[model samples]
Target: MADDDLDPTPVPPRGRRRQARFELEFGDFEPAERGRRRRRGTRGTDDRSVTSSDELTYETADPLPAPRRPRDRDVIVEADDATYDSRLVDRDQRVRGRSRRARRADAPPADDVADEIEALERFEDAIETVRSPSDRGGGSDLGARVLVAIPAAIVAILLVAQGGWIFVVGIAAFGLIGVWELCRMFARTRPSLVASSAGVLAIIVSAALWGREGMTTALVASIPLIFLAVAISVPPGGMPGVAVTLLGVVWIGFALGHAVLLRDSDHGGGIVVNVLVGTFLGDTGAYLGGRLFGSHKLAPRISPNKTVEGLLIGIVTAVVATWFAGLYQDWLSGTDALLLGLAVAIAAPAGDLFESFLKRDAGTKDAGTLFGPHGGVLDRLDAAMFAIVAGFYVWLAMGGVS
Candidate 1:
């Protein structure tokens, strides 16, 4: 069974965070799924129950040989666009472990090809929905709006923050909810309820402790995860095998917490808003540039859509965005805005790629489509979740709001 195939039960993104608590207790990979997929390929060719390999015409012989390392290899193309990573392509290339679905529509009805096709199709559509920029306008217009809206928002928030405490409380609540979404994206799903519940509990406790004492509390508790795996004697593919699961939970939840803290800080500081604006501008520039002029792939193995040209645009945008935001908002000076924006723009993509690696390893898409046309809520916030933390740390280094 694929990571997604482990369970067909649909749950809300909020619910997924609750599930994270359960996930931590169980482990990273699931038991039943790991076993099922492992044995599927290892089964005898003559067995009564033919594996997915039986139906395919691809290589069944010796595995493909590794590529020869080129000593200063010549560029394949005049431009910078590198070829797609075989691994990433393979994930989406051949529909593996799809018991209900076949690789293509040509397959016979016994394979339940129709249902599978529809599911894949819909899921792809949902991904597109999230990827598609809102219908508000095109690049130039959007850029202008961002330029205008961002500074206005920063100024308004800083001014308003001075007037009330309730607003701070509300932003903090948003932070908590965002944290919940982060937990859900990687929650335990296989082996049904048992693993999921364990992950959920682990995160909740982590959060409760962090909420009270701070991140160090969570860090201290995470120290024993590796030794605990040995004590449990669970092999690879079991929950205990996800080497950095404990740390991952902390990274996602705690990192996101900074955004809430910044947004809701007393004395009406605009710490959080400044970081967010910077990240947003950087991402916005990269995205638009990639769409218009991107040719070279940044890291096809991790993500195909990201391009060198786009990345450059993103960096430039981050600086510009920050400068613009800082002009009207006193929270960040020219240098602070530029540096913070650049950091977020660069780091945000890394966070995105990490999540992609996780999802690809699990052989699932979008985590769960809690928000229709948007995949799961976590999918939408993956970059933001990590960016918040990165921004916060950077801010703290510079003597931030706290």
Candidate 2:
């Protein structure tokens, strides 16, 4: 029976039998009591099927979103030989730039500083040129004047050394020239010739009576005589004339009378030579030193071209020359030589400054153009006159040649 039933089941087939089997299997699970159990069992299987299908879709079609290409910051770049070389060149350029900066920092700004210094030097040069005698067109006859003056000076020195009327005559001549120069200096003011002459005559007379017992008396008498003469010969100058006449008598007449007194001394020739040589050397040293190393002005208002360095060098040169003269002539011991040298050094510059003061007062660049480069008789004699007077007094005090 079992065999027949199994075989015939297919034969029963058709719609009615199939519907009957579906109802028989599903009808038990459709009841409210078993519905929850049926849903719970089916949900697990559905989730498994959905999960498997989604995994299959992802593997087959989606391609995993291309693994999300790494962001620029996270990316790693491998260097090639060309990249390495470029990096090295960049490093080398950076190093070169740093080196240039360092070198520039270490060096001074030479161009700017040099330009300023050069400009200052040029300015000083311009100032000097403006004040220099050569720039003022006054050195034209310097060479000729020096030529005549040197020989004439030597002759006068020789004549004075002979110690006779020659000295007296020379003194008289110097007094006359000095008086004439004074007159010329005040010519615009119409200085009295008679007063000037009387002053000069007083100098001559005082010199003539130098060794006589009445020398002081004659010198004292000359002043009143000069004043009287100025009063008598007052021209239009009035009191101005009298004042100038007295000034001439004291300045030229009295000052020059010392020269005659000095010549009358026992060792007059050596004293005169020493004073002259020392003063000349001092002047020469001043000129050379000023030209070579003049930076600071000695007297800016009075003598703009004169320099402190020049003045110092001149004094030192005068000291050296005087010292040498002392040694050669045996006129002074070493200590006395040094002392005399000091005196000459001090007095010479004073004389020069005094003459410069006079010229400034007179509104003149020089006393006169008589000796051209030497300026005038007063110019040549200024330092010598002061130096001789100082030297004579110093020697007398030291008991050297008096």
Best by lDDT: 2
Per-residue CA lDDT of candidate 2, range 159-218, in tens?
Answer: 677866777677767767777776777654455666666656666566656443344565
Cα-based lDDT for every prediction: 0.52, 0.64
Give the CA lDDT, 0 to 100, for residue 114 in model 2: 56
Q: What TM value does model 1 have? A: 0.51
Which is the leading candidate under TM-score? 2
Stretches > 4 Å off in candidate 1: 1-213, 222-237, 240-248, 264-269
Candidate 1 residues 288-310, lDDT tens each? 89878988988765565678999
**Model 2 clash pairs?**
none
> Candidates' TM-scores?
0.51, 0.61
CA RMSD for every model? 22.9, 36.5
Q: Where does the lowest 10-residue lDDT sum fall in candidate 2?
A: 31-40
